[model samples]
Every structure is written in structure tokens, then in C-alpha cells.
Target: MQCPQIVEPEKSTQARRHALWSTCSPPHQRNSPMATTCPARARVPLTLQRSHVCQCVFIRSPARVGAVVSRAEASTAERRKTAVNMRTPRRRRHRSLTATAAATAAIAALSTSAVAPALASDQPPVNIVEMTPELTKKMQHEVDTFFAKHDLPGLSVAVVTPARAGSDPVITTFVAGTPTLGSSELVDATTQFELGSETKVFTADLLAYLVATDRVSLDDPVQLFAPAGVEVPEWTDPQTGATTAITLGDLATHQAGLLDAPPNLGAGCGADPGCENPRPGYTQTMLWDAFAQPCLNGQPCPMYQPGTDWLYSDWGFGLLGTILANVLDPVIETEPPAYQSALDQAFLDALGMSSTELEFHGDGRLATPYKADGTNAFHWDNTNAISGAGGLISDATDMGTWVAAHLGYVPSTAPIGVQAMADTLQPISDITMSCSIPDQCGPAHFQMGLGWELHHAATHDVGAAWAFKNGLTDGSSTDTALAPSLRVGVTTMYNKRLSDTDQGLPLAITLLKLLVADQPAPEPAPSAAPQAALAESGQPTAELIVPGMMAAGFVAIGLLLIIRRRGHGRRSTR
Candidate 1:
């Protein structure tokens, strides 16, 4: 069993970097037989467990001791299984060490026989399933399996696929569990869930409708649409002394450099952001007050150069929605305009989204919202001026139809005569996010479209793109994604609030990956260190690596046992 000693170079950086000997052999045999070709030249096909860090496998063979088989070389079946079964993370950001540990344990709980799949260089054409009875059952199965594993209150899933020849587009809906824990009432396709920020998509669509109708332009300054004598503050560069007015487009694309929420909200919440009733008390007058407070007297209202950076601002969208409302009818009184009703008459009703409302209907169909700890959560009512930002309550059916309209599937009853729907999806800003929280920034960056966030395929590489949005409220979480190229859309709604990683985005993206078989390889998720922008928009971080390390370890052990048995057989035959 004595192996030749391998001498180390005094300071060979390249050798050190490429050395696998440390783990490949005992201390006495620091030389990995992999460093050089084996004289035996036998391709023994050694298999090791998958490694999440590397996203590949190392083969230990008699002839080639350390050959690497990348994710691309692995079987497609394994790839599909891993993609479908990956654990969902609670948040959108990169995972923390504790979250990573929890994810690791979850993955370890999976059947030990499962193998981790690699990101294949060339993915097969996405298998877009047609909406059929059989597909409905399959989709139901996926939904059921997920609910069985999680302790959430309820879920409703909707998927729309391109129709077969001579048929309309196929639509399927799946509902699971009850609206509340231990409730006899069950969730259905029509069960309503708060849309959260997905309402931003609707708000953006409304803006597009106005633009298409020639009521306003994207480049028009916000002050132009504001009520007379109300000021929507603009950024004045102190260094250059040049003043730039915020535009409707800037607000829509989150480039307005506004606060995430207006300052009045802080004053209402006593500066504690986690307060449940922070926004319901906010009104149009408060919004106007926020707009008017900038650079007054000695108060400093510093804004980054508007249109220069991307920041998520509920305050900006609230302002944008208010402006759009004023476009419909100029606000003459001090009272808040009925913006939500105006929005419905203007477009939501036109789009046949009858189930969607800015306020709770007090009906049984609306699922009760629950916090993560299963406590009843205060329902958010955005009936005030800020309704456009996170106001709408919707169900799988209505939201699915809304998504269908985005993909040119608008029914005759609810037609978008102008090109406004398409305009809402045009990329307005390039998103480049930096991670300051260690291990919490994911590789997903976005291009801001009016109300939508766009996830494109690999960077600098041409492939399909998905327009998606994640919505969260105190009680509910929802995710919506659509691939226009494939004419496929998915919406996942949950009754109780889930962590960013554990929310519906992972499930929705997983379903998208299943239906869109040809989706490009996902961009590599960033590590704990500060990293550059995504090279390609891949699957969300939740889908790719969470279970990989644990599954790979199991796979490696199984492969070793097989290798040992085969070796004994060869010796006996010889």
C-alpha cells in the first residue's frame, strides 16, 4: 500500500491551486494519482458525491484518478429531479450561515439515493406542458407533494400553457389545504390572497394604458400630473448645481431615489418599521405632505441623483399611482381620491379581474392572512391613495388571466386594444446589486420594467427571459412568473407569510423550469463574499444549491460501494 512520495514545490501557486491531493490521499501519499495519468490506463469510472461548492463531481479511477464530470455531463433525469425537488429558501437575498445550515439539514433529509444534477451547458427545449386534464393532475401532484412537506395554511397554484393546434390556450388551476390552520373550509381556484407588491405590476400596467391612450407619456415629469400646487420633489445635484425633476418613468422603474416608504409612515409607526398598522392610516394628504417637505426652510431632503440608481421604493410607486389617478380626475379637494375604484373602472374591470380588490370584501372566499408563527395577521387595506403599490387582493384565476393578457392571451371580453401591456414589460433600468450582507445577496439581478422585474437568461448569452415579481405582506406571500417566449405563466399564492427563502417564488420558478424545458442554465449563485453582477440570470438562489452538498455526499457514498463491489468482481474473475 506504499505509494511514491510527491515532493511539493517551494512556492508554486499554480500547483497549490490545482492540487486535489490533500483530500485525495493520506498524508504519506500527498500525490493524488490524479496528478498524473495512471499506467493502467483503465477508465474505472469512479464516482464521488456531488459538491455544492464546485457544482460538479470528481471521479476517482485507476487510470484517471481525478477526472471531473461537470453538471452538464450528468444525466438529464437527475438534473430534472434536483431542479424540481430543491428546498425553498425563506428570503430572496443570499442565504445566511444559519439559513444555509437549516437548508443543509433539509437536503440531508431527502432520500439518500438522489443525485445532484449539474447545470448543463445546453438545456433541452423546455417541455412546455399543454393544459390538459392529465397535466392538471400532474400539476396537482406537484402542488400536493409540496404542501405535504410544509406546514403552511393553504396554497393556490395556476399555470397557463400554449394550446395545442386548433385550440385555445390551456389553463389549469390547483388548490391545496385550507385557508386557515384546522379550518373546515378549503382553498379553491377562486380563494383570494393578497397580491402584495404584485399589485405594482397592475400599477405599471395602468401607467402603460395611459401612455397608450396618449393621456400621458413616460418621460412626462411627475409634477405635471400632480394636483395643482403640489410638488413632487426632484433631485438637485449639489456638486453640479443642476436640478433634475423626477418623471413618471423614474418612479415606475424605481430610479427616483425616493425612500422605501414615505417619512409619514415612520412618524405613524413611531419609527418602528415592523409595526403592523404602519400603512393603513396613511392617506393622500400625507403623501402630498411628503412631496412638499423637501428642501423647505432649513430641513435637508437629500436625494440621490434621480434616474441614476435603482432602489425599491413603495413610496415612489404610491406617488406614481396617485399621479395616474390624478390623470383620470384632477384632485380638487383635500380628501384622498378613490384611486382604487378609479383604477378598477380604468383597467382592472376592463381586464376582467373582478375578484381583485384594493380592500377586503369581508367574504369567506378571502383567506385569512397569518403570520409565520400562525397568529392572525392584520389585513392590509390599501384603499387609501397608496393602493397602487401593494393594495390588490386576487386569486389564482384572476391573476392567471392577468398574466395571460401579458402574454397576448387577452380574451375578447377583456381586450387591451393598445400596446400598453407590452410597453409595461420594456426594460427601463439595468439592475446591478451589490451584496453588503455576507452570504445574503443572491446572483439574481433585474431589469426594471414599469411594474415588473425581468430575469434574463445567462449574461451576454441569448436565451429565454422571464418577467417575474415576488409579493409579500404580513399575512400572505405570492409569486408570479411568465415566459412570454413560451407563453407559459405560473402564479403561487400562500395564505400565511413565509420567509423569503421559503416563499412561493421557489415553487413558481421550479414549476417554470419544469414547463419551460429549454430554460438556459441558471447563473451561478454568488458566494458569501462581495461579488460582481450576475453573468446570466439563472434560476433563483433557492432552486440551485440548497440541497446539493448533502445530496452529493449521499451519492458519493453509494457510488463508492458500487465501485468496491465491482473491484472485488474483477479480482475474482482475474
Candidate 2:
């Protein structure tokens, strides 16, 4: 049957009628709000799984039904008015607007009233993540299990919630385990730890900020901006046998044809004797030399032509950092050299990343890295070479704020920073991925964005679902991810290094699922039957549609009156 907006009848009476219908109707006929909760699926013959069974519901006596529905709706409207009249009323603000503002507001209202209906796609998914004692208890147990599985010294996670009306955004900072095995120092959100490649997001964003300022274009050739005496190399793709122009954008998107690590990188007592060690760093000269060298592994990057292959390369970002450091040139005055100091000013200080140090400042507050056996290791730092790629330290709290800024949940950061964050989330590279077409079911299939990895559950658009970056060093593991559409961000830092940060991924994914997943379908409605039936059918009832329709009509009428009056004034003057 066609979906027609029917007047809502008396809630309880309607419920009784619907309940009778539901009890008698064939098992396949009842409406289900979500496929996940549908009972009809159980009755489906296994052989007929590929086919869909649609039960069409039809009602006779249209005139009689309409008459009853109209009268019930009238009574409901009256009861609503009576309730409003019984309540204490507050003064509503009605302000006179300037001529320009009035005209602008009228145009805006006209556009919104006219356009919003056509664009409404997803139902404004009700996202009520309960932080009840029971929920917290379960979450804590999961967190404990995750830490135990990884044998982490400690783990801290910060979840920034979506903003609600009349309430500030909520941040739940949960910390578990010990910062050190022998010591009693417990890790918390405030505990400092190296964020590693998570810093690359900021470096990529700095390039975006410069673009927004018209200082540089993403299309600018990397060779034009590389530091003096540093030379980035050319890559001839073995598969395609074509050389492509590399740009700053390529570096940001991991398409700059660079190796995974700088060439000359080795383990177990190298020529310089620090190569195999966990804390070794390189200078700008070393970085340039490494970029000029050939690829060590056969994955991609310097091994392949730019944009022809997708390779996760820290060396690509190292090139980007060199360009940014030279192009920006000590935007902040700090004890560090020109390049590092510029990075500090442009991002670290600008983002209020006080807890994130550009280099090891000998700060005792740093989280001590622990060996798998739980013995202490020297905290990792960076030299000018690799520091730009994965050399920044941050805590869970600041990382959350960084995520918040990226998702545009916070306006405290610089506007350029916001733009850059948005820019970085744009999916640019594609993995060898194939998904269920048309409706888009299946795993994310691993898409790449500028300095970020994108989770494409809903859409492939930048910031549509989640944008993420993860980091791992010999000392720590960190993951930062944001879902802009849901206005949620998750960040975690752990003292012990892990081969995989899948433990933290589950926590972050769980939080996001709570934000985006459809509400429990089988749950009874807060209102009685009429409204519940409408909701379950995916059809907005007359009662729900009428108020909005009325409001828009009223606003449009007001706008017409104002515009006419303004036109009259202008004509009279003329």
C-alpha cells in the first residue's frame, strides 16, 4: 500500500486495534524498524533466503476510517493545547532585525524551508549512549581484558561524546593498569606518551593551512620547496613503467613515491651503530640521503611511480616536513632549530598541545616505556629526520582535543587548523577493495585519506564516517580516530608497544557504533500505538509532519510580507 499520512488516532485505542491486528496478522506482515530486529527472518524458508517476502497491508472503509482518524486527531490536538495552557509559560524573545539581516534571514529561511525536505536522507538516528553503572562496569571489564591480552603496562582512552542541547560535550577519560611494572605510577589521560605517526596528521594539516592562506598549493611540485641541499627522488613504476610528478599533496596522501623507511635503515649494530636500537634518530642530511637512496623492501613508494601504488610511508611525510619547515620558517620562536620550531608554532602550540613535546625535553612527566616483561626502557625521542614523521609525544586528553578539533566539535583551534583537519579526511587513495554494491554492505576495505585512513561504512566522502591515524613505536602504541558525522572522537595511548592496536580499535568502534547504529528496534515506543506504528513503517504520520509543514508555511508567509514591505519602501523612495 502507498504511504499516506494518516491522522493519528487516540494512542491507547489505536494501540489496542493495532495489537489485535498484529496478533492475528500473518507472521510476515508486522513492520520491523530494522533488519537486525526483524522476527519475520526466522520464518523464512532457508531455500528462499535469496528472495524477499513483502506483505502489503490494506484497509477497507476509507471514508469511515478517515472520519474516525480526523476526530481522534482533533481530540489529541485539543489535549496538547490544554497541557500547554496548564504549564508555566516563559517569555519568548522576539527581536527586530536590521534591514540587511532581515533580508538575509528571509532568504535563508526560504532556501532552508524549500530545500531541507529534498535532502533529508538518514533518519536523525537517536544516539543515546547510556553511561549507567552497569554499562561502565562492562566497559571496564572489556578494557581490562584488552590490556591483559596485549600485556600492556598501562592504557588510557579518551572518548569525547556528541554535544546535546542544554549540555556541554562529555569526555570520559578512562585509565587502567600501571605506567611501570615495578612503580606505582598509574597512567591516566594526563599521562604523557609518544603519539608517533599520529603527529603526521598535524604535519599534513599544516600544509593545508598554508594552502588556505594562499602560501602554497597542494599541486606545487615537491622539488620547488624542498630544503636547500636536500633532493627528493624520482620513481619509475615497475608495473606501469611510467614516472609521475610528485607534489606536496602526494606526500600528504602517501603517494609521493617514497620508501616505507629511509634507505640505509638497518638493525643489529649498523655502521652508525644506533640503527637496530629502538631510540635511534636521523638528521635532515640523513633524511635527504635516505630519500635519494633506493627502496629496501618491494612494497611500493620509491619502488613505484607516484599515485600508481598505495604505500604507507613515513618517508613520504619526512619529505613533507622538510618542505613545511623550510616554507613556513620558524613561525614560533623556540630553542629548537628553524624547521622543528616552525612545526611547534604552527601546530603544537596552536592546537593547545602543551602535553605534546616536539622533542624529549628531559621532562620527568613522560610515561616510561616498558619491555614486554615489564622492565623499563629509555623513552623514545626523535632527531630532525624522522621526527616529522613519528616523533611527537602526546597524552590521551590532548589527543582527544586534537580529535575534537579535527571533527569540528571544538572551535577553539585556529580556523586553518579546522580546514586542514577537514582536508586531511578526504579519501584520496584506494586499496584493492571491492564491496557489496548499490546499498554498500561489507567491511571498510581500507581507503586512504590525506595523512589519515578512512573507515567507509556509510559513505566514502571525507569525514563521512571516521578518519583515523595510528602509531606504534618500540615504547608505546596510540590510535586517534574521529567520526565527524556523529561528532565523536576516540584516542588511546598505551605504555607497552603492541604489534597491533586492535584492542583500542574495538573500544573506539564500540563508541562509534553507539553513536551511529540504529536504536533497538523491538523496544516499545514512548508514545502509545499510533506514533509507534508510523515510526516502525518508516512513514512520518500526519501529526509528525503537520507541525513542521505548518511552521514552514508560516515562516514563508512572514518572509513574503517582509519582502513586500521592503519592496514597497524601495519603490516609494525611487
Candidate 3:
């Protein structure tokens, strides 16, 4: 009879052949026999008696197969099954894992890119001459003691020196206390605080710019800038009753015979009430009305001729700001801009003081001004309209840059040279104000510069006849000084009110001494171009001294490896 066609499935057929070959082998010699027989069966089934032979192979192999044959077939089938399983689901899992790993790697890279350097912690080690660790610690301790004694909320101090070619200027900064009592934020190098009368330095610089451009002269009379129909205050010689005019130089040096406040302070307000309107929100119309008023009942007329005596006057400085604004307009030709805009453009911008500004409101990083009692009830006075004299907000970091410029260690935006900065710090007039009695003024203990006060003979141990200024409002006090004798500069800002004679002056003296006592002797003047280049570049010398950038790179690389391993783990799961 014709054999029924044996349509063995390919997988089963192969398994049967494997089993048959394994059974024919001796138990002890199974490996050699099975290998030879399996190939012979494979050839015969495909070539001759294909249908019947294939059917017989499947049936006979299963019955007579050795224990080893069954085991071999089982093993082969299991391996094939495993391979199939591995190809489908396993392949999909591996692909999913690869995608996850790639995504994780990408996210890690993005995170690294987004993170900025920790500016506070990453400050390069500056080479401040003689700033030994011991001295730094002692200085910080003294500062802390002073703060506690004076009940101040916060303070910052910086010392900068001239830079030599290929070397960074020495800088040592110390910060103390919280920026505000109610917050956990520590004072950083960048905390913006009110600058008070320290603003005058920038104003004086603006005037220098005007002078450089020939827009205004130092000797120009005040009447030249006052608004039309505004009667200039008559300055009668105390003995002669003869009127004298004040010049721009007189205003700049506080020798303009201007009062401490606007004349309207007593007229519109009341007698001895001048302080009441110290920062009144006076408009242009109000200023005009106030200027028109006659001298008060008991108030003395101009005591000294313009350019004869040096007296402090915010009004004179305010008028200077207005004149600067007007002079700058013909050159810049813009409308409705602040009087200080010229200063911002001509000086602050060129100095890379990106954070300094004439006004600060709504900026969260700003240190809150506090009264002596630590209450935030005071607001900075904005009524000056003439903001150049006492309206600036700045951080220690930016002030450091300003100090560098003053030291001639950095270039200024103005065309004025080192001699010009020196001129600003020179003694313009001998200050003869009484220390104890009002009219019993003594010989000059202080002198006036263009916009600075010269301590020709400071009463403090640390200070050495420095160029200085101090500013105070209701709850803010600031002092900035350049000790040329020591080649050091310092700035201190506090958000609390203290007596001018007590807390403010003493602190200034102490900081000046701390900075001067430890400074190294000045090196000879460096080559001009190289020093100028360093100043112009403003790159911190610490960058070259510290390996911070290298360390950051290594950290970034380790982060990548960790991210990669996490991705591999996720991929394996898939």
C-alpha cells in the first residue's frame, strides 16, 4: 500500500532526527555516535523515500530513542524556544531600555548646562597683600563687635589695590549679619544697599564728563542754570550787605553759600522746621514757589561769599544734578529722562556696574532699610528730584569695581586720567566748622574735594587723612573712603540710624585702620598699558589663581557617569 504522505512539521522533524541519533549511541560513547547518525538521517529524509521515510523517522525515534536522545531533543527544543522568545519581547525590552538611557543622558546634560557657577562659594582666592588668615579673622571679629554695639542689621567691607601686569588687584571682602532681621538670607557679596551721599562721587564724575566735553565750566555762575523767573538767592557779604554770585565750583565744593536744605524748608513749612521738609515730595512748581519766598524771620542771610566757605548742602548738589542733566541733553537729546541718566551712561555702564542704579524698588535681592530699632517702617527718600547728590543703590561687588577705578587700578569710562581722579580727591578748601561750638569754628580739620571730604587729620587710629564721604537718612548710613596713604579703599553700608558723631564716624575709622594696618607696601608703578588693559578687562585675577573651573569640569563628568548608570539600569529592566 502507498504510504500516507508524512508531512512532518519542520521543528518536529528536526527534533525526531536528533532523538533517533542520540538513542543509537552507546551510553558510554553517546556523543560520537549521535553526531554521525543525525547527519545521515537528515540526508536520507530529504533525498529518497521522502514521504514514508519522514513519517517513519518521527514515529520510530520517539519509541526507541535512548534516554540521552530524549534529553538531546528536549535541550534543542528548549534552546530554539529561548531564541524565539529572546528575539521578540526581549528585543522590544532592549530597545525600550536604550531609549530610556538616551533620554536620561540628555536630561543630565541639560541639567549641567542650566546650572550656573556658585559665585559666592567659587570666589577665586585673591592675593591681598598681608591679608593673613589671622588678620582676616580679627577684622571680622571686630566688625561683629562693632555691629552688636551699634545695633546695626548688616554691613559689608571691601579692600582693593592697584593691579600689576598679569596680576590681579588684591581684594579682601568681609560680610556680617543678616540683610534683614526677619529673613534667613545671609548677606552676600551682591546685596544692594542704599549708597546715601556716596552718590556724590558719581555726580562729581558726571560733572567731570561735562567739563571734558566743554558743556559746562567749573566757574559758571549758578544763575546760568536756574529756571527762568526763579530769583537766585542774594548772597550779601555779612558786613557789606553787598550781593555776591555763586559759581559752579562753589556748589561742587559746598562753598556756594547754599543752606543745608532748600530755602522753602523754613518758608513753606515753619521756623526750625527745615528738617521737616528735608525730603518732602516737592514738585517743580513747589520748588519754584519755595525758592521765591523771602528769608525767614530769624534765619541769617548768606554768611560767606560764594567760594569763600565750605558748608554741606544737599540743595547745591541737587542743582548740580539738574545742570548736568540739561548739559547732557544738548549732547544726548532725549526727553523726560532722569537727571542721573547721563551718569548711568557715562560712568556706571562703562564700569560694568550692571547692578547699580539710581533707584531700586521691587527688586527682591535688595537689603531692606531698617531703623535703629530694626523696624522696616522707613522708606528711602525719593523727593530730591535732584537725585545725583544722594540717590544711588549698589551692591558690594559693584562697589568693589568702583573702588578699583578710584585706585587707578582700573580704567574709568570718562576721558579723565589718574590725575583727574586724584584731582577729585584733592583738598579744595580748608573746612573750619566747629567741633563743639557753632560760631567758634576752628582751623581746618577737614577739607573739601570736588565731591569728596578730605580727612587731613583724621581722629581715628586706622584712618590716614583719607578721601571720604558719609551719608545718612532715617534708617540708612553709608561711608566710602580711599586711603591713598595705604593704597586701600573701603565702603560700609548699614541699614540702621546712628548718631553721625558716634556710630557712623567710629565705624568708618575702625574699618579704615583694619584695612591699612595689614596692607603690604606698594609695588613700583607697573607698565601703563598692561595695568590699563587689566583695568579695562576687569577680569578677576583669581581666575588664574584658582582651579575652580577645572574642578567644576570634573564634577560635571562624574555626574554624567552616574546618569549613564541609572539609564543602563532602567534599560535592563525594560
Q: Any idea how many clashes model 1 has? A: 23
lDDT of 3 by residue, 102-165 (tens): 6556555544433322244443334243444455566667768887888777776655543322
The clash numbers for all candidates, in the given order, read 23, 1, 3
Query: Can you give the lDDT of residue 100 in candidate 2?
Result: 40
Give the higher-lDDT candidate: 2 or 3. 3
Whole-model lDDT, model 2: 0.55
lDDT of 1: 0.61
Q: Please tell me which predicted candidate would have the highest lDDT against the true structure.
A: 1
Give the TM-scores of the predictions, in the order they appear.
Answer: 0.62, 0.62, 0.61
Q: How accurate is candidate 3 locally (lDDT)?
A: 0.56
The TM-score measured for candidate 1 stands at 0.62
lDDT of candidate 2 over 1-574, digit per residue (tens)? 1222222222231121110010012112235321112122111010001111111121222232222222323565698999765543121112223444565566556544432334334433444342333444455566677777787777887666543231223445567766667677677555678777887887877776677656788888877865567665666656886766788877887766565676654421236654445224455555556655556534433554566555667777866776677666742211223545555444444343455656464745567786555666555565455566877887664565566556654333233434356666777777552222212324336667778877776543332367777877667777776776556666878877654434344455554554444222434434334556656767555555556556666666676677667556755885
lDDT of each: 0.61, 0.55, 0.56
True-vs-predicted CA distance for residue 88, candidate 3, Å: 95
lDDT of 1 by residue, 460-540 (tens): 232458877878888888888777777788899987887556644257776776666643354555344211222244444
Query: All predictions: root-mean-square deviation over Cα?
Result: 27.2, 19.9, 34.7
